[model samples]
Target: MSAPRMITVWGRANSVNVMKVLWLLDELAIPFERIEAGGEFGRTRDPDYAAMNPNATVPTLVMPHGYTLWESHAILRYLCRTQPGGNAFYPEAPEARADVERWMDWTLASLNDPMRIIFWALVRTPEAERDMAAVAKARDAAARLWSIVDAQLEGRPYLAGECSIADMAMGGFLHRWFSLPVERPELPNLAAWYARLKTRLPYATRVAVPLS
Candidate 1:
């Protein structure tokens, strides 16, 4: 009998998208190898890398059978659908799954832009070169978006009413938002949800990390 082929993930550790995949993998106890690519590691633009991921993005997944997948949220869904115990995270019920998926979509569609702006301005840009005005504007936008999340999480411990990929999708960004040196509106539910996520070991080790 042949040994099972291990899954390979390509991306730098600090990337929020990559962190989401890693956190899920750890939660599922799935073994995989990670290769450094993108950011300072710099293979994203290589022809071979582009062949694997034309978007030149990080968190590309090479499956055990040699198939490749990209897009972090899509990858999260694929992993949960295929791996053992994945159904617990993704759910088999249509309505339940949709609840999980909508937040994933919202994270990419509504929350990502302002979060990216805030993250880049505050973390990546040097203080002398920092755009405080842009940071403040993005911060306000992000706070409003998080307010939506806060409302959604009002009676639930996690998005979709249980721990699911929706939380994983937004977890890293939540950590970054709280960690950033910007003024933020008081969001109790969001803060409580974040505290709940922190107790999960995978979230603490993988999603919550010092921003680069």
Candidate 2:
């Protein structure tokens, strides 16, 4: 058998994107070395770092044999495809996998915009400097989107009916949503699904932390 590959992840712990990869890595039982490199850590702009990821984004993956990859969702998909137990988390069936991909795409295409507004306002921006009006509007928008997810979870435990990449993608943002101080409309199903995810050690320790 070939020697196990060494995987190194570059990004700060508090980043939602990085947390997605970390949570999935833990679930896959993959060992990796993580280097702090974004937010206050601030090495993403360095020439060497930029060479690996021109976008200067966090959560860049440095694989064995010098392969490099960036973009959080892309990294999540790549790792799932190459590592053992990949199919368990990222099914191979066209329809089943598409179900997972749709949610993951929804997170990026739909949910993230409003969610980021709320996250930045409440978590990143100081109270004295917050734009409360903007925050409120964004919160409302995000809540509506989450309600759709709540309805999706009405009779299922995971986003795609079975634990898969969809859950990993959304769980990172879900952790932020429930943790934020803003009032949320009743989303019991979403709350319960989050509660179930909390039972997982990775979600408990990594994803479900104080907002940055």
Candidate 3:
């Protein structure tokens, strides 16, 4: 492994995507400096920031050797691949690693579809202008997705086994799912898995904060 290098993360603290990376960094005990951008901070639109990350998305990572990466999940993989103790979290065995990747991919490809809509409606949309009907439909869809996860957790402690990056990716969003005002179905297994995730100090301190 090359010498350890300082990393810089650009994003607002409250962003779920940003929080996911932060939680991973903390879990790995990697030292990093964070700059608040995006959302109300508004630095993401700056020309220099745009040049670094064309998407202008929160959680852009600037690594040693001038390597820049965007997309929260990609950042997670980069850190895991390069850092010591990565195999435990990311795994070197192809099958073991794929087990982790599937959940991380599902977090974006499947879960985010409904979860994002509901999160925005309930958390961002003002009560007076909010469309409760739309929120309800989105919430129901998200619940169905969570049920699938709940079933997966029935026989395992973590999604990909032993609390890998898969847990962090899904746990980041799970915070929103559990915190929302909408009623949740009785997903005992999912609840237990979440409880296990919460026991991590890094997750509790960084990712479990109040939602915006």
Per-residue lDDT tens digits for candidate 2, residues 1-212, read 12227888999999989999999999999899898998899999999899899988899999877888898888888988999998898888899989999999999999999889989988898889999999999999999999999999999999999888799898988998988898999999999999999999989998998778
Model 3 agreement with the true structure over 46-160: per-residue lDDT tens digits: 9888988999899899887778889999999989989877667898899999999999999999998788888888889888988888888989999999999999998899997
Q: How accurate locally, in lDDT, is each candidate? A: 0.92, 0.90, 0.87
Instruction: Score every model by TM-score.
Output: 0.96, 0.96, 0.95
Candidate 1 segments exceeding 4 Å error: 1-4
Error of 1 at 187 (Å): 1.1
Model 2 spans with C-alpha error above 4 angstroms: 1-5
**Winner by lDDT between candidate 3 and candidate 1:** 1
Each model's backbone clash number: 0, 0, 0
Top of the candidates by lDDT: 1
Compared with the true structure, model 3 gives a TM-score of 0.95
Better of 2 and 3 by lDDT: 2
Total clashes for model 3: 0
RMSD of each predicted structure = 2.3, 2.7, 2.8
Residue 43's lDDT within candidate 3 is: 90
Where is the poorest 10-residue window by lDDT in model 1?
A: 1-10
Kindly report which residue stretches of model 3 are placed more than 4 angstroms away from their true locations once superposed.
1-5
